[model samples]
Target: MVETGNRYMDNVSKLISWGHWFSFINILFALVIATRYLVAADWPPSLLGQGYMLVSWLGHFSFLGFAFYLLLIFPISFLVPNEKAMRLIAVFIATVGTTTLLLDTQSFTLFNFHLNPLVWNYLFGGEGPQATNLLFIAIPFIFLLQLTASGLIWRNLKTLHQKKLGPVIATSLFVAFLLTHTIHIWADASYYRPITMQKANFPLSYPMTAKTFLIRHGWMQQNEQEKSNRHTHPGREIKYPLRAIEVNQPQPKMNVLLVMIDALRADMLNPTNMPALSQFAGSASTFNHHFSGSNHARLGIFTTFYGLPSQYWPDISDAYTPPILMTQLQQAGYQFGLFSGQGFLQPEHMQTSFNSIEQLNMAEPISPVYDGDTQAVKQWQQWLNQQNNNGAPWFSYLYLNTPTGMEVPPEFDGPHQPTSTMLQAQQAGPESLIKGLFNDYQNAVLFTDQQLNRVFTTLAQLSALENTIVIVTSAHGQEFDDTGNNNWGHQSNYAWAQTQVPLVIHWPGKTPIQVDKDTSHLDIVPTLMQGLFETTTASRYYTSGLNLFGPLKRDFILLGDEENYVVYQADRITEFTPKGNAYVLDRNYHELENAEPDIQVLMKVLNELRRFYPNN
Candidate 1:
């Protein structure tokens, strides 16, 4: 029995040796095939970027080959211990892997996106089979090549082992892999565009980020890290507007006052929670079915100013390009007064929306967001009074965050009963705690509403209400486990509770009509461009949105952050992740088994996302 066990162990060892040699050969093959990806992607302009590209390519594919060997061949070596059966299985696995890689490369080359279930269904579902048949023909050739290589590696395993080059090759690959991650960490911390921009070039490549680690060790400061994350590469170029904006100056230039409340949910605007804002909405052109461009303040505000999807954020922010809306406002001689409860440095709005404004007020005050809200309101009121005296049409942006912080002053009693503090609710479990937290959110909203009413009263006192275009809306909606899935905050999902917000537009001459049509924060820019500036430029040139007051109809709403987005239809939501994978969920965000999105709508969405780029 001992002799038999020794023989079996020897066989397994030999098979393991053969597997390494096989993996090495396949790694070469994979490297050759992966060149397709390099050819398809935008080559880096810098020498460092090119060096990173080469090393990452070598390390990534080497890792994949060894991973496959460990996962598939290593187990089989012990189980089967038969060279011929192992060779056949190995060949089959290699063939399938290679074929999948080939298909992904092709997909990436054509679409600039990798293969996912949604893309697979779209590529092979209907008439796609006929178009893709030519690509499928290469699978047999791949299988034959893998089979021949597997047999050759097995036959020469002893000679390869005697050569003893495996250790040297393995060490080189390990070094290359380690170097790749190290360079990525440095590049991410430094915000090196040439290196950082290639983050999504390879599929499933999640390179290491050292911002937090460096900050912990005192290698980097918190403010420096925030700037690094938000700073866009100035080297990159984009065609924003696609053409120059032509504005026919209005007869009487209208002042625009855009009031954005943080974490103000649509449901919180009722008579009970926010009586002041609800009463204001009754007189203004209120939108019942309105959505923010994103579930977070940063991108939501970006979409409002840029009139574009969040996908363009990186490119636009990288260039430090102000939105066309802001540029138009500046050119039209609109004086700017921007105030935010939360500092703009964190989101780097000063680098994007307010990039062109000289000496902009980025924030009012920092701690206890309630105090910041009060200061912001006071500052805006003072600015509005000054603007009333000046003849120039002024633009004032007041961003309040008291509701987002869930804070209220001690003097003002919260009418909502059974309310728990944010800390109390967070420490407790998620059953009835969500209800108490929600009541707390209502109290916060009520406090914010009172602040907003102060602005309206000031406007009425100065008689600026007749000439100012006062638009009240939230940056994004706050969530409170409305779906009962423990989703208690924004940026978690694209559900109604997180995306929906109230839009009350008090246009000077427009009738006070309640609009039930679907609208977005994106529409704000286009509406202002058409109404105030009287710009003849078509909305499509710079915006993905239509005029909110002009024949508003939408088949779907596109809402998301930088990496992932959801195409929200009336019945179902199709969420696309960073990897391009699609998840079909019902209205309440419950996963719907075997459901797919409308292909036409997805096609339109893809176009909308890519249209702003220089070459689409």
Candidate 2:
């Protein structure tokens, strides 16, 4: 019995040695397959970046292949001690793994993103087999290759073990892995573009960052305020506009004033809630069915100015490229007076939208919400006077933050009763709390309308209302537990309560008519470019929007920030998260478990996301 036990131990040791050799060969296979990712990625410009990319490519896949062996095949080798059984199991595992890698590479190349369970279901579920038949065809060949490799490695196991190069190769790979991570840490801290930009190039790659760690350990010191003030610039090249803009300036260039109210819901604009604004809308071109490009403030504003989807915000912001509209206005000799109740530093609009403007006002009054709103309006009035004296076509942007803060002056009377403070509402029961919170929101909107009245009164008094083109809209709509899933605020979903905002445009010499068709903030820039400047350039050249006055209607719209977005069709919304998870929901935000994404809409969305890049 003791002899038999000793023999079993000897067999286990030999199987482990054979497993190591098998894993080494598979690592080589994985490395060769992973080259597809490098090809799909934007190549690093620096020599050091190129070297790091190669080293990381070699090390990452080698580590993954070895890890797979240890976790799945190493234990199986002992359970089934026979060499033939081990080879069959290893081949099957390897084939499945290799096939998955191949599928991921294809998905990444086409979509500029990787695959997850949702994407996998889309690829192999339902009619997906028809779309991915070619990839499936390669599976049998992969199995045969893995099988042949397993057999060769098994037959030559003793010879490979005798050579004893395993330790050298393993050490080299481990060193490469460590060196890549160390380089990423330094690159991230120093804001080194070449290496830092490659962070998302590799699938399942999350490089280390040491900014907070270094600060905590006293190795680095950075001013918190200055860091917050700094804007993010793009790490890669992007061709915004795709080409130079050509436009014929209108004979009598109208002064444009765009007023954006924070968290203003479309439904709240009525005789009861916002009397002054409701009256203003009656004489302007009011869009009853309108949506902001995103539920988030930054992206919503970005979309309005750039006339592009929110996904491009990061690239545009990072590149410090002002929108085509702003540049055109500048070239037409329009003076700019930009004011935000909430300072532009947080979203860093000073670095993005108003980047080209000289002597920009980045300061907002440090006071109560009511005082801030009052001051912003006063500043705009003063600026308008100065512009009128200069006799140049002027463009003014006034952003109010009253409704978002849900605060009003104590002296002011609110029509909405039984309203609780935001904190009080938060502490109340969920069902009862929403009503009170919503009441508070209504009162805030009422106060914001009063400020709007002041602007209108000033324009009329100066007789500028006839020549000035005024646009009243919101950056994004607010939410108050409208989804019933305990979603209390914006950025939670792309539901109507968060995306639908009031859009009332007072274009000079144009008929004031209510537009009931689907429209978006994205249409704003394109409208100004065509209607005001008479630009003959096609809308597709610089924007993903149609002219607001155009007869063509959009069949669908997109809403979200950089990491997550939803494609809103007529009856359904397909939401996608950063992790590649997707959910098909009805118009009411209820998930439809059996529903599939509309392929046509998704294809259009994918095209828009990639078209603005340097190379298609």
Candidate 3:
């Protein structure tokens, strides 16, 4: 009878030890969740059969890590505990985690289809948050049950002569993972992409590890975030200081006219047929290496106009503030007008910033249709004439979308065997019916350039040419390769062809300063401000923008597509640099990428931002 009792006690002791380690494993998974949430600012929802949503999109990545960790460490959780019970615990932890992921995903989908108006709308027909009620209940049981079981088992092991290394390693990883899961429960959490940021300064951690990260990464070297911004804004309070100093450049009140020819490439302009743009490029400060924020018109327009890079805000279409240049110019009594053929319906966010928004008011397509040069020339001349009616000098923002149509690839390249979804859609457009569609598309671009010529001619005719600073650029660049790598459309891929854009600044009063260095579309705002206010500007006080007219040359241009992020180094234009290397593109701005090159960081952030803003 005494021998039987000893065996029973041994079984309990072993069971307790096993539970403790298993609990730690569960905690490790939790840490992964926390870390992702800290970086992403939320959990991932499952996708397809799994959970996935904007805020929770990073979970897909976390899921990969979790699976790896599980496969490697899970078997050990049962080394000392009941094998059947340990398996059940594993199932419980996984099931609950999976549930959380899926619930988050479902929330995003429902929010997108039901709450968003930008897409062909769908209604919320599911149980909504109520559908995941079971997950909330299961999560705690799985988490707490393991936590309690772990503590009891740890006490039992101490009583016996038990080796704790296996338990220690397993439990340590588990706890770290669990804590990581909860890292962002606090407000004002900032995420750092170790590779993309010039300084690999990650923000916030628990007592034992926080200082270590800051010290190790040399976070103090260039702590831009710690610098006080406090710019002397005209009407608003910003972070960057633009006050208590005067610059010799033109005042902020200078009548500045910015024209964005959608999808205009650097080589797209020819001086002979499109002499006006060529004149601007020749006479003005030409940025032969200017790149756009995104390859899409929506992201391009917002970034170039607002003086904020597209990577900062995922949902560009919803950001409504006027481009700092326009806002400052307006404060200085400049009239603003935005003319587009597609109507502001696409970049609907334009309404909040643009003073006058006019589309292609058509009873019928004008004889030349879409991007008609003669009609554009006539209209621009008339609009240029109208600027004088209001005693205010004008700051015109013209966005022309004539050559904006997509073209079918003559070949195939991409994820599948050529789904060609977008190309097929483009084939249905009017360009498809036209002979030599690509040639016609090129002609449309030439015509658009010609129309811009009319604006220049009218400016000269009105004698407004000498007084104005004309900026000729494009929102995004387009593509036509049927290559397998085609992400389809602008800004979708991280390739140079998608983001490279034309930048020409013709300041009549200044001597030629050829800016052949790499520059971003965001610099347009600060550069214009330098010409106008002759001062600095930032979102708060520490705006990262460099003065467009400054002598600084950038070695890298940080590029982001909703799913991918990369720092395209200017000096190494022909090749990719070692990841994590900091490089400057133009004066005043530098970019950082991680040691491990993963462009997906930008893509994930973009997807999340899209999910958050407008809940779309």
Best model number under TM-score:
2
Q: Which of the predicted structures, 1 or 3, would earn the higher lDDT when compared with the native?
A: 1
Q: Write the per-residue lDDT of candidate 2 for residues 1-616, one digit (tens) a residue.
A: 0124576666767778778877888888888878988888776656777888998888778778888999999889779877677778888999998988889887777666788766676676663546465888999999998888887877887788778888998899889888879998877776666677788766788889987898788775555422432233245566789877777764436999999998899898899998998898889899998899999788889999999999888667766889999888887878888887666765437657878888676675446877888989998999888777878888899989889888888887887866776547458775556677788888889999999999999998888988999999998898887778777678888888999999999987999988887788889999999988888788888998888888747778778788676887888889877656678998888999888776556657878887887655
Q: Global lDDT of each model? A: 0.82, 0.81, 0.49
Per lDDT, what order, best first? 1, 2, 3
Number of the candidate with higher TM-score, 2 or 3: 2
Candidate 1 structure lDDT: 0.82
Superposed Cα deviation of residue 130, candidate 2 (Å): 7.1
Clashes of each: 1, 2, 62
- The most accurate candidate by lDDT is 1
lDDT of 1 by residue, 141-194 (tens): 998998888888878877887788999999999999898899999888777777
**Could you estimate the TM-score for every candidate?**
0.86, 0.92, 0.55
Residue 214 in candidate 2, Cα distance off native in Å: 3.7
Clashing pairs in 1: 232-318
lDDT of 1 at 196: 78
